[model samples]
Target: MTKVLLTGASGLLGGNILKHALANKTLDILPTRLGGDFSVPEAFRGDKEILPLDIRSQTWLWNIISQWKPEVIIHTAALSEPGACEWQRETAEAINTRAVKFIADLCEHFGIRLIFISTDLVFDGTKGDYLETDPPNPLNFYAETKCRAEEIVASSLHDYVILRTSLLLGASPQSLRSLDERLKADGEAGKTMTFFTDEYRNPIAASVLADITLKLASGNNRSVTGLFHAAGKDKVSRFELGEKLCQKYGISRQFYKGARQDEVTLSVPRPKDTSLISDALLTVMNFPMPSLDEMITALP
Candidate 1:
């Protein structure tokens, strides 16, 4: 069995990874979340316990690494909110960038492979269908941190896979983690949801991402190391995605509105088109990338 340590077990992708890992007999997984009083869905609470870990603390991280000695460390924890990252720059750097550096160092020292989750936001949306070779031009602090973390992972270890994904749509243990869930919650609260019509992304289902990530972590494909795009096949606008979700869940169109990126006053500037070309990873894994319609249909 491949002993795996999964960080950010409380997040959408990480939680999904934990669920899938639990079902896989080949993996003995340890899911870790930042120490807190947060409540997780029962589905994520499998036979294995979710350990409390503050990746910000190097000592705590070192102890976990030394004690567990996992063959693979799937590091997914990060300060993902753009506004929050801009407002709390120090905390974001410490969590997203510095912690990743620490993890990379540990992974190198212990000869453990690392699978780091990155974002498509690393590329300035001027260009869509980004390849792994595209130079990252992050527009916001959050993206900047993730880009830096990606560099750290790449430069620090040869046995690392930096998976850059776009907007994720799926159910999380916490209802607010995924885009669809957040939209549903907002619509249920009788709030008007406005999505940017100009902003585009190749959004993938969290389950799909988890499947690919676990497959990489399975130690069955050591040759898959390097940066790979794991987004959806459809390059869709945010407004289109929201509309689809509304249609799928029978939510009234009245609650949803489409506005251009320029119309809204955001705390940080957003890229216009961050659609990714996931052909590289999909081709290698022999996996089919799903479309937005297919993903929406599969949504629970």
Candidate 2:
């Protein structure tokens, strides 16, 4: 069995990874999380213990990595929220960039393969269909940190896959982790939600991403190393996605409002169009990237 170390087990993508990994007999997965109680839904927790890990602490991280001696380490833990990252720059750098550097060093020392999860926001959004070769021009601190982390991973590890993904839409283990869950929560709470009509992204299901990650972790194809893009086929705005969620969940349209990027005052500047072209990874993996409609339909 391939012993895999998965970080951020309580997060959306991490939870999906754990859920999918458990069913695969080829993988013996050890999941870890930080900063809170086990927030992953009980349904996804199939007798697996989620260990506590503060990736910011080198000693704590080293203990886990050295003791576990995993064949593959999927690093997904991050200060993902753009607003939070902007407000707390130091904390964001510690978790997103510095921790990744340490992890990459550990992977190098132990001869373990690393699969790092990055973001599409690394681009400036002037261009829509971003390829793996495109130079990153991050507009926000969160994206900037991820960009730096990507460089660290690339320089530190010879056998690593840097999968840069777009907006995620799926049934996360927690209520607020995925787009559908957040929208549904807002609807149930009688709150009107405003989405940016100008901003665009090729959002993918977290489960699909997890599947691709496991394929990399499975070690079936070692040639699929280096950077790749993974996202849905369609380029859609947040307003369009919000409308779809309303229709799918039977929520009222009155609860949803569409606004341009300028109309919203955010802590960080959001990209206008960060749509990714995932053909590079899709071609090699022989997996079809889903459409926006398909992604929404597939959500549980």
TM values, all candidates: 0.98, 0.97
- Which is the leading candidate under TM-score? 1
Off by over 4 Å in 1: none
Encode model 2's per-residue lDDT on 221-261: one tens digit a residue.
55579999988888889889889888998889888899988
Please list the residue runs of candidate 2 whose C-alpha ends up more than 4 Å from where it truly belongs after superposition. Answer: none
Q: What does the lDDT read for residue 260 in candidate 2? A: 89
Which candidate wins on lDDT?
1
Give lDDT tens digits, candidate 1, residues 1-300: 999999999999989999999899999999999867886777876767899999999899999999999999999888899999999999999999999999999999999999999999998999887898889999999999999999899899999999999889999988888999988888889899998999999989999999999999875576689999989899889989999999888789899999997888888988999999888899888887777899889988
Whole-model alpha-carbon lDDT for candidate 1: 0.91
Candidate 2 Cα lDDT to native: 0.90
